[model samples]
Target: MRCDNGPELISAALGEWCEVQVIVLHWIQLGKPTQNAYVERFNGSFRRKVLNAYLFATLRQVRHLLTE
Candidate 1:
């Protein structure tokens, strides 16, 4: 999977899980958002479809809506 240099995605826990699953997690260079185009596109789609279409007062509510 290709992703940005976010702390959560670069954490040891996620690294361990990827190792266990034999998956390679590649991070794009800092300040280079275009390198992670797929994630950016998905995020844009998600924002348009879910975020912009709702008004959630809490993080939990957002998470719940996403899971749905």
Candidate 2:
């Protein structure tokens, strides 16, 4: 997984979980958003199209919409 040095991603808990799962994390350098441009673009689109367009009351509703 390629990700920025965000607190959540850098947490010890997550690191341990990844270690157990055998997933290698690739960290992008600070101040370099271009390295993760694809995910950034997708996040922007998801926020605009789905998140901003809806008022979800539950995880089930969000999952239902996402599946469609």
Tens digits of per-residue lDDT, candidate 1, 1-68, equal 88888786878999899999999988889999999887789999999999899998999999898788
Q: Write down the TM-score of every candidate.
A: 0.69, 0.87
Over 1-68, each residue of candidate 2 has an lDDT whose tens digit, in order, gives 89889787889998899999999999999999899999879988999999999999999999999899
Query: Each model's RMSD to truth, in Å?
Result: 3.1, 1.2
Residues forming the 10-long window of minimal summed lDDT in candidate 1: 2-11
**Clash list (residue pairs), candidate 1:** none
Question: lDDT at 66 for candidate 1?
Answer: 73
Q: Return model 1's CA RMSD, one decimal.
A: 3.1
Maximum-lDDT candidate: 2
Q: How accurate is candidate 1 locally (lDDT)?
A: 0.89
